[model samples]
Target: MSAALPALTAPTGRRVRVLPGVYAPQHDTHLLLRALAREAIRPGADVIDLGTGSGLLAVAAARRGANVTAVDVARRAVLTARLNALIARRRVAVHRGDLAAPVPGRTYDLVISNPPYVPSPHGPPPRRGSARAWDAGPDGRAVVDRICEAAPSLLRAGGVLLMVHSGLCGTEKTLRRLAEHGLSATVSDVAHVPFGPVVLSRMSWLHGRDLLDRRADREELVVVRAEQR
Candidate 1:
């Protein structure tokens, strides 16, 4: 069974952005942040926040005395996150690139992510716009799969990866993928959140694809924590 975490006080809104395309914090964001809170981060630990939308995770890590590097694929997200870090007075190194590609040859003690996992009937992620923040390709594992594939390389010998995604995208698949990549993984946190506008709009398609049940109006999100030993 997945564990539970306390809710946090920070803000959340996937498409609610200060910049045109930068995704604001959302429920999943808060979920991951709460999971990060439960971790006993060592002082000066190396930390990387993948898809650091508003630099919330990075700033939080920095506040905890961890050296933080935030990465995002969207330029606007990078700018907004940097602005957030600046305004918050937290020193965070922000980068722009797809998933984990930006930080090569560097390993982190803790890698955190709240990635795009909404299952889209459409082909691929959008070329632009706020939709880029939530639209994952069919089955919603596009970015999550990339993160799993990158975890073994990005994590130190005993480093940890904390990632959150919707239940519509197979939580078991995530756990198994991480294990296949040699990380001891488990569901560390879980919460049931109502379907957002995007998911609700795609309800018929979701049901047709068997990704969601007809009567289910809510989706369960799981936070998978994987540790390389």
Candidate 2:
């Protein structure tokens, strides 16, 4: 069962509620939307919100006057996103399929994601296992890697790509992967949320980085922005 999620009201007069245990869009929606709304996106630019958990970004983009399409592999997420869009009274295309699969024959001026980026040991499987929702491989870059590889084809010339993951999951590795895929990345913003013990266990990976900081209680979260080369 998915965890219970809270309902949030966007400053744009939109109401959003993310389903529990299924990658709620409430957490990072504000940080991401703030950065995105400040960008030079044309009034009617095409946008894709990959991993559109609750369709937060998709709804945000639509409100910003862009043609937005949200894609996700989980049926529940897709349904939730579409419903959220409907409740917000925005016309967003919601696709139920893996990354980039349902978006074929179309390209976007901007692509964004807040994918599941926590690395996990090969132990007990999740009561709700969703490779597309989380489990970013041993290094926690699987989904990011795949997204980067496919982004160039999906992004238009000069299109921008924005993403949020974790500092523990090898931010540098993500930057390098983006480069390999012809994307250039820079840390536009970062947030610290005490994610508790399980999250702190991965802190060693972030120790030497300039961007990470540990809280007294120990949990943390990061938001990174990348652009297509």
Candidate 3:
């Protein structure tokens, strides 16, 4: 984890096509990208980017010379990611499906995700639209839990997994979950960012659930890095 990163904004050189209903590259993406930049990926390292919204991370890894596959559940996301990769002139295989489900019978040198971790009072993540990119279940652990469960199977003996999510979902639980799988894990980086429109709209519900203080307007986003033992 030691490479220079550009500013915590969208990459300026390459244009990303943000289609409607797809999550656009934002602060959370930048935070995770910065964390990804730290890793010293060898040329052609096998990498899979789960929940690849616009293929930003996958393309970034490809730029670093890793073989990347970008996976997403939303159809729009899959298309947008592919287009973005094409625009960036990066080699990325874009697939449409749930996290890591589209690819089986393969282990990677690295796995990365910027999953849907917003604490939504809604029943589950939307099956379509931009909300699918961020509205996780009540505790926001729905997707996070799945990633933790899949880590062991998805990684090679010495492979790494890097995921970014909100602290509202329980950072300790994430670390514990990864450790339970016999992987060494830690919160590698954190950013206290202001709530976006989605969370801001659900303020009352989140406060009712005691997930946030009445006056709290910002939340901490953390990148959890884990390595196979």
Clashes of each: 3, 5, 2
Q: Rank the candidates by lDDT, best first.
A: 3, 1, 2
Ranking of all candidate structures by their TM-score, best first:
3, 1, 2
Cα lDDT of all candidates, in order?
A: 0.85, 0.72, 0.87
Error of 2 at 76 (Å): 0.9
lDDT of 3: 0.87
Error of 3 at 184 (Å): 0.9
Any residue pairs clashing in model 3, and if so which? Answer: 1-38, 2-38
TM-score for each prediction?
0.92, 0.81, 0.93
Model 2 C-alpha lDDT per residue in residues 135-213, reported as the tens digit of each score: 6655667677787788878887788888877665777777787788887777776776656444456555544442245
Give the residue spans of candidate 1 off by over 4 A. 1-17
Segments of candidate 2 deviating more than 4 angstroms = 1-6, 9-14, 123-132, 196-220
TM-score head-to-head 1 vs 2, winner? 1
RMSD of 2: 4.4
Best by TM-score: 3
lDDT of 2 at 61: 87
Worst 10 residues of 1 by lDDT: 1-10
TM-score of 2: 0.81
